[model samples]
Target: MKKLISMIAVAALLITGCAKELKVTTAENLKVEYGEELDNTKLFNAKESDENVKVDKVEGFDAKKMGEQEITVTFTDDNKDKEEKLKITVEDTKKPVIELKKESVGITAGDKLELKDNIKSVKDPVDGDLKYSDKTVEKDGYYIDKGKLDTKKAGTYEVKVIAADKNGNKTEKSFKVNVKKKETAKKPNGTGNSNTSNNGGSSSSNPSNTGNSGSNTGSSSGGSNNSSNSNGGLSNNGGGQKPVNPAPHQHSITVTGYPDVVYSNMWFEDDTEAMYWASNYEGPNGDWAGFGYSSDQCSCGMWSPYFFNVTTWE
Candidate 1:
């Protein structure tokens, strides 16, 4: 009876040593972004200690949408079934928020415009600032419609600024722009400063040229000095002809996008005189002195407001 008992104990030991082993090690809760594909191997650390062990099947998971899902991993060891389960969370259901602050602005006909200036901020609950750039104007994105103003013609127009977030959330606003007609200068009459050496229109020492009726002449002293002054004045006169761009006039001129720049309240002689765009010179304070401008609208740097409330003499 002692020998038989020893043999049985030895057999039990052998049986225990031959038993198959299987294990599944993974976190209880896993997280993933919305719409991301799910992989089984990456989902869990599963393995069988015995060479004959195999994965039988896996079930109880649907990651198609945003929600919590349960995954069951099943395996077989020597024809014996074993199972384990884990929880997966599909998050990212929050949408981005955008606010349009400066929804509208009025600019001159020839001025450049930026639609994004309308946006106060672009924010998201999950991902902060979106760093939105011009690329946001592409398809499934946003854009500005510079409608009807003709940009070259003076009149009232409706400009539409639109935007969209990464999750397809969208918003838009409209601005009414009033482009007033450009001001033009007129020819002076022979009544006032046209008199030669005297206040009246008569002088032989320096005969007044009646080429154009109201020519102004505060004849600068000294011949060469006079010539230089005359040349400068002529160049600015829109065409070598004296201009009577006198003013107690008010203009609501605004400059945007370019900073530390300069622009002028020019007095064009005619519509065709628009060629004098290069004549933009800085004015003194209380005028257009420290305004901003960019020769090319497409590449203009920063954005800021430059309001011109001009009051000019002759």
Candidate 2:
């Protein structure tokens, strides 16, 4: 009988020792972007008795809502229910998108041009289509940065467009505006005149006294005639018009030695023009080298020294 009691006690002890408890491990806090759906597979890990367990469902979390919220996760282990609590935060960190109709726009000089005409749309995932704002300080719409747009000049100008969502998420993009010179009409040629004058007289009178030398004393009259003609020639070399100089040829310089520094479609009208533009180039992040051309060699260096060759085209 004591052996039987000992066996029963041993069995009970073994059963108690073999019993397992559900254990769940999860992050204390989760961060997600606005409009992102919650994914359960990435949330936590659950196991019981060295075996995997299944999550039944999750509660107390809304994906659409922004800000911090308490979340409760539920799972099942060995036909038993369990719950875990954590915090989730949904934020609007994504920037708005600015779509442009064209990367570069062309207009004649002295013509009216609106910056908004280049923009196709400005959209935010949460705020829909953004409106246009003249005030640069506003947060919910798009505005042009502080810069002058001179359509009266014939050159390339950069236009910066900034967009912001309702949550203060901002985006910036730029496009080029190429202003061209206007065409002029040509004038017609002028006419020239010529004049001629003739002053001459001829008289044929048979001088009978000439044959007879005796009467040579008769009165003899002689008259001389002169004729003059003046003709004016009009020369219309190019119709007295000024020669039209060709437009400034564009030259592209190839940059080398620096992989991090990138240049856009940049060109120079001439050596002087290139130096001037490079001197004024502000770069993308205020760290850029001004371009210089000397002795048929083109190079740029600010953060680091780099070299490039100049290519000319009409």
lDDT of 2 by residue, 1-314 (tens): 99999999999999978866566677657788887788776566533222455567888887768899988888665566668787889888888999886556667779888878889999998768999988884578999863766888676678899998878888999977766655568675443231211222222245863475455334243332133233232223433654478986453445545444344444443333333344334455654333332212334422222223322222
User: What are the root-mean-square deviations of the candidates from the true structure over C-alphas?
Assistant: 15.9, 15.4
Given candidate 1, what's the lDDT at residue 216? 46
Displacement of residue 220 (Cα, Å) in model 2 is: 28
Task: Give the TM-score comparing model 1 with the true structure, all chains together.
Answer: 0.33
Q: For residues 1-314, could you state the per-residue lDDT of candidate 1 as single tens digits?
A: 99999999999999989975455455557887655556655555544244444556768665445578877877565567678777888876555566665323445667775656766766654445656545435423556666665755665567765655455555566755545455558787855434443332354443445443355454444343333233323333323565667865443335555444344444343322222232233355334333222232112232222223333444
Candidate 2 local lDDT, residue 220: 40
